[model samples]
Target: MTELDLQEYSHSLLLEVQADAEAEGTTTPEAFTRRVLEDLEQAGVVANTFTAYHKTHGHEVHGYGVSDSGDTLDLFITDFHLNPLDSKLGKADTETRFRRLLTFVRRCGEGFGQEVGESFDAYDMCAAVGKSLTEVNRIRLFLLSNRVGTWTDVSANELDGIPVTHEVWDLARLHRHATSGVLGEPIVVSFDPPLPCVSAPSNEPDHSVVLAVIPGRVLAELYAEYDTRLLELNVRSFLQVRGGVNKGIRQTALEHPGKFLAYNNGITATASQVEFLKDADGQPTHISRVHGIQVVNGGQTTASLHYVMFRDRKDLSQVSVQMKLTEVSPDQLTEIVPKISRYSNTQNRVTLVDFSSNHEYHVRFQQITRSLWAPAKDGSGKETHWFYERARGQYTDGLANARTPAQQRRFRDLNPTSQKFSKSDLAKYVHSWHQLPYWVSRGAQKNFNEFMARIDEAQPRVDVLYCQRVIAMAILFKAVDRIAASHGAGSHKSMVTTYTVARLTLATEKRVDLDRIWREQAVSTTLEDAIDDLCPRVMHVVTHPRDGAHVGEWAKKAACWDAVSRVRWAVPPTLEAELLDHPLDEVVAADDEASSAARGEVTLVSPEEWYAIERWAKETRNLEPWQRQLAYSVGRKLELGQGVPDTQVAQALHVRNEAHRLGFRLAS
Candidate 1:
């Protein structure tokens, strides 16, 4: 293998180091900045980042990236006090910090050629300024501070004819965003008193629609305040499809601001829930807060208002747009929100399937998961079930919340917490399996949209068995990922692993005989062991490109996938045998027999304990599949051995303590 100097650590690894350092009461600048970048990546703020840490010219700029449309995305970051809680920055101090960010934005506007050399790699901001690195469309100035200052003047405007917007990820916002996935934080929007609005309740208990007239300026302000975090996936994708602001909106706002509301269809939005403030008479006067606000329709209108009012500097005092806000429960959010978005935006040429969860593929997968039962294991006495959560929060609040304790137990017996995977996760796996690893690395929402776009184009209908096989493929992908991680290929940790695994599958597809492995429509131990054996070699090729070049950021880009697809490598004799030989063949009869024996053995400890562990794993702990399997295996051993052997007792106690740490309740 060729040696490439991986001297500069990735942002993910740097964050890991930062966490370890903080635990020991020490911190480094490299670690802190990288941690901030990692936080931004996790929150879906930015996809891929390249550090341009030029000693002289990297002051106003930290790094750069390419937008989905191939525009240069300049990143200006300021690392404020590592501990915001300990910072005593006053109002003036905070304003000064924000002003510095504005100055940096101005610097980017000055021109990239001026700050650094004409050659792209001279500044290391981009590879080819003359070729692919065209113009800078967005300048994201991230103020990594512990304090949230009252800075509202950072409005959406233009710099040297290019539209500019900024977002401040302060400590409070960062902490809230970091925990939001686990705690389900509400999107709070506090409005003035006497906020005139009308609420219409639906037959569904937790769903409703609220109608209100909001000034175009107000909407622009919110868009400016929240940035992309405000828009849902459907709306966000629509806005991208429409490009920048539509000329029609600007003309209406500029010429007839008073009649703009009458001529326009306004906007349709959705929220998880809405909170209201009441007057002395107990009538709802103002909408106090809204959870998960997303524009379902009139994305063009919403974007136009923001552009016309903010960028065009047009008056919008009389340009009030009607907003129809549909409030759905969290459990129903994923299923209903996209439907609302698609149904409302009929004026656009957007594909309905891309905005639908009821597509034939998803429906077919749901049927397959619900009908087929996994055999019982670890003496549970009941067959296990797999619940394919097509919608967000379906596994927890949607299905599990309505079931009785015993019913939930049976569900857990069939589908352990580890076997649980979401629709978005499935999309990544399916795409990776097809050798589209770059798309898989684009995060869940983007990847889901990408997958659906392909589905809408190809209309490749799948059967129940095919759906089951896809799930089996996902499990095998995860097992291989663990093996790679164990081998210290820490760079494969991100969604990028989807591409690596895809490359591996594509390279080895001819030899592996995937059709034979899929005959049973489940992940068998023989298949798992085969994947485990191949992962190290797969990861090695992925980490070290055969051309004696470091496959660094290239792996995250589409070019890497294209390059890997054209390369060929040698496979070991044993791996070749495992791939080529069928399980029923005499040469592989021993493995087939072992698999048959495993089918009858109990894999779970106790049904009651398994249920509790599964619940804890999904809701409280959010443990990985391997972690859940370990806990289940330990629990089973404890039950079978009655905590007799000292080693067994120690292992059992260790897992029991971990369960307690994850907030799992103990038996009385």
Candidate 2:
């Protein structure tokens, strides 16, 4: 917030960019832009396909991401400067850069790829944009810079009749985002005519509830403008399925518009602030505007409204939908928003792990990382913690909490910035090692959601060994990234890295001795050699897409992984020599054995408890049919005064644990 603080953040960010550039053998500007894009992507400010392209002509594009719906295109341009944290980006320079990016978009729409060959890095981006031009309804031009500047807001314009908006994320803005833990800028919605709403009586002082019947047409229009920003708190994206809720929504909108209110579950929304339009009698009559409005639930309904209005060309004049808007205070936004989202989505198939940053898995993982220090690497003689940022902005918040420079330095010493990894980073590493490179390529947030779903189902124990293996995977991923960069992977660096690691994991059959890597705090030279030998093959498969498809999009497909998996590259003998004799299962079994020993003896449940558990599970519908049957069988065995097998006891315990996780409360 202060000038000194901004300068410090800028300097730290610059250093990080330089370090990444050095590691990847890339230019500082390229690294800086990539880092910024990664932050924005994780923040949900942008979607997938982050390709870097630069042109020397009056046109240039640092990077771009197409929204999940393929209707919004985000174009990024950066003005990165070396040193001089006090440097300022003026309006003239900003406009010049903006125009250059605009020219690039215009050229793409005008089929500029025909002029340049496919060998160029920008060719794929230009071609993809050109192909999606018809579907793209909005263009967001972002100006990323490390310099201090007064942002001159650009009014929304049209690009080939499609709406275009401009935004700038300068040093101060990035610093604020890093520290504040908020996802991008707040979306302020101003109603032109204002809608009537009734305030719900709430005794709570920190928040207020309002009920409104929003016109379906107005809701569609709002979604058309805000898109996913309105659903930032929502866990899922637009399902886009023809059946289920989407189909029913479309049918209701078309056949029984007036019944939509009675048929639909409506939407649960939250906002930081709201303005009321009051009458002369000092009674609030209309809701005028909302600040930081996010639909925590009913994202499907909101997106369906937009879908029907645009894709089906259906008039929503007769449709009205109910809405419950909770105006939360800024102080409670972080604490209450996720709870609101979680509880509202419980009725759906969404589980507790869907909103899982604060889940026990991550909490235990974070605790393990904090307590378990990694071995000193490169003769540093001092161990460091691989800080697992379970929540966003935690590492920075930790540094901020240090207050003084000395404390901050000690904090950095104990937890190096390079060692700091977020939940998405962990997901990417683990998923790549698990041979799901396609999932890794699906962007951070989505891939993380998928990974969390798996964690929810598997319920893997998070212990010291698990933390070590995760860090080992992280080290492997980073090593591959560096190798890919050194080999001039260019825009395909990420895909190449993930695929190469995946191929190695597959070739080795999950026997790579992650414990050794964890002990050394680095990868073996033989393993690095194996990765180096396979990087070129992976790059070839990634760069040469069949039918000349976009490499980025191709990498996100299972077929891409399939093609890479079938490559003729074999694991080097030396690398194979480094692999463990048994698979990772053996290691996990050993850990389970030690964990079991630590817990002493497993107490067998009494027949009464087994019967109670079975009854509770059946009543709550928490267990699958097979699990319920197993529980019932065990209960029957206990009732018959017959001994139950240890397996059956374990099964019953698992069922009980799962039921507890699903919120099946029992009388103590």
Candidate 3:
């Protein structure tokens, strides 16, 4: 065969392989789609969870992802035996397949939060992310297949309701994106007639400051188009500081629309490129598409505009807000982006820890990891050290310069499993292990910032022991993750994926005698065996939800941990020998003994409220048990003033209202 023909034939063979694999097990396509969708993360898509089901309401959804921004994606991975557009196929067959896809989109849209799918409870999934049909700004239907084709029928691109958009990710497209390292196009915000703007040159010619009066309606439209992608990390936190409409911005917009520019500080935005539509005399007419749009400041104003217009359903045609657009060249993005984020966000301040990577915690972790050595398994006297990567590319750079065999061995000693653990990974594993999956699910950067804040409040100074504990927790998490993957592939391949394994880890951690486990300074073989035993129970808890609770929400919060921790599992007989003579046994035993007396006082939720809560939960049929449980926990915290100040009263009230809507009752 000719080279081109050979290439085409090889493509056909690969598609056949994918089709065969998918048909053999339900997880094949789910896993494949997950690997493919992970690429979207580079494009700024922060997905919290993935769901895979054999069938969702009599339709095979294959898999889907729920983003942190409350957007839902319906994934369909098609691995057909024959190409639908083959010459042997009749026109009728093609039409039928196309119409079937349209039906799938409609079905997915209609069944948004329903639990008819094989994945986790959709209702619980939506509730955990605070998403509802009304709140879901967009529903993306992604059709992925090995066979290449375009949807020439433009009419079938979107569903009528819920702002649904369709996309096709064929094998060719996936290959290009994966190989080229190119991101999807940045958002383009255009202003017709080129709204008048003034420009000031910066230090670099490629970078300039353009001041323009953007229509409030246009800004809201831009927000709707980009969602959370537009907000810088710090800006997202600032907007989330309080709930409900900004009374000041609202009053000004509602009462005096004309004074919006004068009253507001306006939004500060960054873009990779900006163009102006100009007249013959070179006077600017309006803005063309502003590429790579990001809001470094004025996230409140941007979000407030969307909320006021879409949520409040208010008119914004008469309102116009000011915008300072910083056009940045691609080459200077790395250095300039952080600076823009820092200076533009003066009103809603962020700290050095939030933006910079040169924090003391990272330096301390590097020291701890380098100083500590892993236990020698074979009694060789030689031990491996865990290389805690404080910065990106540090490991690779070190390995590249290794000249001697000892140096090479040193490089290898930094175990690969633990090598990639960054501060973000530390935040994720620690929070998820400690029963804070909700924060972990909020995207890595957001979770890292929160974890840093917690560290600041709880332990202003880092110590060796605390760093050791963090490292130990990460090791355990990694061990569990590997075991889960092995089990999924070998035993329960159809029912498990990495994401499910994470959820299962959270459940298993509840059953784990943390008091006992923590005593062992390291993740030893005995703890691994214990985790293996706990996996079955974790799977049971995940697949079966007691009391009709929202399992997803329960799993995300500490309430589930509080419930599961009450149960104590005896040591598995098979691992008793290993546990008895474990190297760290004495230390662990000492810690456990010291903490045993105070265990009862360590409850996160007050035991005093149990009777009243149980009665209230039993009486309230409107709310899911999980909702009741969550509300009670929040209520208890409110009573205890658990870090919540009077300033957070409005947000607290909003939480209460959400709980009530979900069927939690108000106290008389």
Candidate 4:
């Protein structure tokens, strides 16, 4: 890390800062200022660059730092200014003003150069500059207003240095332990006021859309705030503590037997367990893998669609057609994708056969005449298909399942063959859970009941999602607040609305391409208001990992922003040395297999509890005086052997015949 030191340009700026009181001097200085400007021009400066002209001998108003955001600016012609309120140097005589301005400009350039040389280490200096960097942005602003030189040919690596900062490191640290740690992580999002449900027109058939897992807080905030107001309702969080959880960590850990021991193990990472952040382009960008939370392998460890996208087949004559596959989750692909077509314009069909099944796919390809398409929000939006389709698949259970003679008669009436079946008939062809025709059965009730059940199990994720959303809102609010404080934006609401709309419209996934339409006609305030209104209804099924962490960073930017917020963090010190020696796999094996973090099981102890345990172990001596070598149990400290040895606390409860305390039902 390079230390901060003022450079030559900084000195020039400093001189201008000094010129606030300095009277303009001789015309000789103006000549000097003009020559410097000429050299800067040769270097390709885009902004108002302060140049020293030995001939004219003074600084002059070059360009102003131009921001397209339309924020008001008060400018100075003679001196450098950090703010608009600084005094102007134009009051002095023309020749004198020009001369002093030239002197100040020279000073700024020399000072900036000095600082660059002294303050930065080779690594801290970027190989190149990029728009993402705050320093580059500062340069951009200076060029717009001052007689700044353009960037001639800085390499890409130099540009990258512009954005690097300690703050970036701070924000990145949270994502390391996302999935399993106290740090928010590997989020399972199920949107409430479901995205497409609200956006879908009444007439359109709803299709599931994919929410691809993105790695950064940027995308995380985008998803959370896209419709935040709608998300807050009935939202919950998953961070409740264990028994006597309110007690400090040590006390709580002591009550829940062995929990702390497991924690000590989990935090100790081996070479394979850690994940680090990548750049926006998904290339590794961190110093090392410190902590990590991985995406769960819940659905039988299937690979991501991204990892193995189906492309070319062996048969060239199959007539390939490009098609977009969005929501291709294993469940949806397994259960519903047999009905989906590979292409809407071509005669090729694709079937998602079970990964374990050996069944052959039967595909039918068809062509249709072009028809008028519907609009997005209109009630007459779409009556049948949501998007285009080309082919279909048929998979039937055994025909032998039908009664012999009656099956033939029913088959004759229904006819085994039709060029194309209607939606209702297609539904009938698919078996129903009740053994009736699927469409006729109106599985709506069944589907709704299943949805409710899922809600019951997945609610913790939703709570986490809500907290995440709150964090995103707070961060965006802070960024906007800072930006607006610089601008004249009247209130927090107005500033947020403008930026929010811009951010959402850019980041959100829409059924119809909003960006395409937005280019033709800018977003309406009504749409912005609609989005704001929708925020409370947008709920996710997990804790807020992204948004919460980001907001914390934002609030940390200033002491006033930080307020009195305190975050409690922990690491298993005992496991720390272990992490250095063993692999993560070994550590995980040693921790608790307690799947339910909700269960009470903290059996670790603090020094105070350790004292109590040793004292109790001394008192609770085992039988046989000669058998002093017998083990002493720290039962009282564990507080576990309770209630017939049931629940997690049972083993430590010390009841001799705990098995008799509970019973199992006998077979009838």
Candidate 5:
């Protein structure tokens, strides 16, 4: 927010990157580049198939990501400096880096895989990009730097008639994004000829509502340009259910374009700001531009429209669809936007699980980490916290919130950046331990979504014991990760580590004493030895894909897991002796105490506060119809000064909790 804050953030980020390199046993430059790519993937700035490859001659490329449809390719090049905080990437250097990345793309399009031997790490990526060139309509070249950059404008060029755009994610830009509450870069849509719209009457000042009929052609074009960035808030991916709504929408768009408005549910969108064109009476009549526009609902409809217009080459000139656009202030974007998305899609059976970050499970898990302290390790008497970053920038925010140098130092000592883990990291650890190695091998974001879905189904209680088990899982994962790095697993290290853990779990029958691990804060040496023994065997199975398939892609398949599972590497006798006699219980009797304490805390909220929460939920539409009725009943009972039963109180508390999670705030 200020110059001093920026400086502190920059220094902290560089230190974190260096710490990652040390933990992963890689050079700082490689780690810095990989970290940047990982962040970009998590932020939805790039697709998930990003692989790191650093090879330079007359051209260079650090990493590459290919879209699922094969229509978009992203290439990255890094420019690292020793003194990143003080260094700056000038315009000329930026242009040169972009050119190098473009040259690599050009070569890949021209079948450079032949020159790059099949044995090389990058050969598969090169060959794939070369083969997919015909389908690739756009290529984005990124220059990743830890230094500040003087270049601001993104230059667009073409290679072999395919549009190639250049972007630079320098230190300052990366810092701004990290601190900002929004996801990825904002999509600012400017209409060449403003569309006429009618503003809905609204009593709220934080947001305004508008109703309009948008041209189907315009929607398709916008999708083509922005793609999934337009649907960032929409958790649902475009599912092609046969003969379902998607197919019907496509058919209607092609056969009855003029009737789309009458048949479809249209789209619900949000914007942080909007420009209006008013008539002589000063009444808003048209929308000229919108900032931070995101489609929260009707993703299927939007994607179907894109498919019909672009893939099918259908005329959408006669197609018009209704749209409800909510212009929310920047301050309310994080809080209100998710509620808008969740409520708008409730008719489709979307639950709070779809918004996993805000789910009660994660919220409780975050609270546990904050309150629980880990045992002191390495003979130090000081205990530290393993910080679980439930949301992005929280760990940094913790540091930035400290008012003085002494407070900052104390914060760092307690919650070291090295001890920090994200939701994706937790997903990878838990999924690996559960013997879903293939899913873990998939990139972080995808694996995290799958893990959340499983969590929804299982509905495990988030108590002290559960939190300890999660930490034990984290400890086990990091131990295996370090062992894998030591064994020269190289690019296949992640697959090797996950498979090793999964195989061990299967062999030992999930009998590891996670409670022991949590108390001791370290894995037993015998167990580490067993992991060491399994690493090379797992590596062999993962790296040697059947039919010479790409190892990375193959690692994501069930067959790979099956092959690794079939390996005859047994847990060593010593480690087997250390395994627990029985599997850990799904629930502990002690957790009931914790649950009762939680409920007691909930009941501590005064009746007046509950009434206020009900009113807020009503005004904000934060609760479901059923939940709203319950809230009203609770309010009525409180108003009548009648004692409410514990069951009714708990239900009311649940409603209030859900509303709070969705950003409902009672008047102070």
Candidate 6:
């Protein structure tokens, strides 16, 4: 037969063989294809046997290419039928269920704290999300030492700059990060990394090297939710003793590579392939735990995440204040901020974030610096600084070192506006917020910088909505501040009238702080400028603890949150795009300029006399401004008699108004 005829005839025979196979308990495409290949091999039909297999597209992973030889398939040998015996060689089963994941992560974090003999911080919590303490803390930046089994080049001997402690701890960080994510990315670690140890002994110590062992991908999802940085750094430091290098291993490292490999086939081999033995088999192994787990644009996107280190409280004094606010209904915050909830750990050292009702414009207190508002000379917190704030605007806890607002503004103003900034500018801005690398405060800063870099350089250039969001957020904050301040400060008496009036009076529109984002890119301006335009809302500021023990005011109350705390809740791509432009108002038919302008309303009402007004209105079935004022006076007198603060009296009325709106009939 002619070669062409023979090829066609062969194809037909192969198809017949595949179609006639007897049923097995289970048969996968790979297994069936393998059977066909085996028969063909036995018949001695040479050339490229894979050619036929590639033609039939039936596999989880494979690539198609038009080669010089014509259409060809690049099949993943890894995608072949998994031989249970080969794949299971050294792998261990793990807890992959959600419940088990929750438990395991809790233990991983709590146990890490006990080991470190200190309370956990945001750094530790971040480590739980798949970062090593060191990497998350920016103790050392990730230098891609190896890719797969190959080493890549990093110019100028950057490795020389890293300290041994950072290198070792970094490995632990990477290990934790790997264990926390469901990453197809290789779970890798560095070991006994060659660097100058932070502290080394003159003679060889019992443990000089550091080992970083990562878990397989099975537990990655769970680990991804944690910040493994502190845990990783601490683990590395713990492992380092006075010997050779400290070599440590995680329980997860023992799992076989096959679990991570896509296909079960061809995973088994002689020990040489895997170098299967643990520490006893070779040199100290270490890898950055959180090195690969990136935080994107201040937690805006997941594709790229960078480091946001913390601010050290030791470098400067701390301060705070609380403003009682007029109680407003959750609906008034619709499209505005909804319900705000908070939670604190038992020690109150770490506070998880607060979620808003609509889940927009949420807030969280990562760390609370001391009361910087106190008397500079008195040292006691008796002096009330009485700082006014637009909470919703670009609010910062307290920069690494907050000098005068003017000084910071000048420093920011001097920055050149001409850098071709995508986010590198933001990174530098964030990085500048740091004073030292080792300090805990620097970790969050590093994280913020890293997150920005990640988004700016994401695979597809992470969306720009992250930039616009801060502006709208800033304006609302300022407006809220104003409205609340003019109204009531948590006084029950003014609760109903002032708060309800404020809601009805104002309009909440999304507006961008253009100067803060595009040209000036100033932190203070981002906050002060936007907030200055809005009415100040009443926010309670708390000062020194009655016993120097209280960490935050709303701690113990924050509980019962299920899903993970989101850094940037995912907003639809289109909505985020819209965020770039400043929010404008509807233009009038006769005046286009008016469309760009925002309309303001006033809400300067009292809540205390609301009850008296209600009583008067109920009896006369009519309402008047005079009657309302008298009612407020009556309520205020009653509240004063009870020793309740004026603010409390106002808050009561506000709460009553909200309740009444919700179908609650308050007693006249």
Query: Clashes in each model (backbone N, CA, C under 3 Å)?
Result: 9, 0, 5, 108, 0, 143
State the lDDT of candidate 6 residue by residue for 469-562, as single tens digits.
2222222333333344343321111111122222211222223333343322222333333232321221111111123222121111111000
Q: Write the per-residue lDDT of candidate 5 for residues 129-159, one digit (tens) a residue.
A: 7766777778888888888898958679898
Residue 259 accuracy (lDDT) in model 5: 95
Q: Model 5, residue 124: displacement in angstroms? A: 2.9
Q: For each candidate, what is the lDDT?
A: 0.53, 0.79, 0.53, 0.23, 0.78, 0.23
Q: State the lDDT of candidate 1 residue by residue for 51-160, as single tens digits.
A: 43333332344444444433335454554544434444455654555455455455444554455653332333423222332354445555555454445245565655
After the best TM-score superposition of candidate 3, give how far the Cα of residue 597 lies from its true spot, in angstroms: 30
Q: For candidate 5, give the lDDT of residue 90.
A: 90
Q: Per-residue lDDT tens digits of candidate 2, residues 275-325? A: 999889766678899999888888888888888887788999999988888
The parts of candidate 1 lying over 4 Å away from their true place are 1-184, 193-213, 224-229, 233-265, 271-292, 300-322, 325-339, 347-360, 371-387, 391-413, 457-462, 508-511, 515-556, 570-668
Q: Candidate 5, which segments miss by more than 4 Å at Cα?
A: 240-243, 346-355, 585-668
- What TM-score do all the candidates reach, one by one? 0.50, 0.85, 0.63, 0.17, 0.84, 0.18
**Candidate 3, pairs of clashing residues:** 194-285, 194-286, 194-287, 195-286, 519-588
Lowest lDDT block of 10, candidate 6 = 265-274
What are the per-residue Cα lDDT tens digits for candidate 3 across 1-668? 24343334334334434543443343445445544554454234434434443333334444455554343444443443344234222334334444454455455446544544435434444333233444565665555555444442323354556656556665455544433322444567676746788777457776888888889998888766666566643334434213333557877787888888898889888888888877898855567778877777787788777777766778998899898888888777656766777777645444433234556667766877777765544455555665675654355445546756577455656553233456666777666554455456444555666666544323323455555555566656656655555554322221222223344344343344333434443456766766676655554544444666545434444444444444345656654544423222111111333233222222343434433454555574433465455546555664675643322222233333333323343344
Residue clash pairs of candidate 2: none
Query: Whole-model lDDT, candidate 2?
Result: 0.79
- Score candidate 4 by lDDT: 0.23
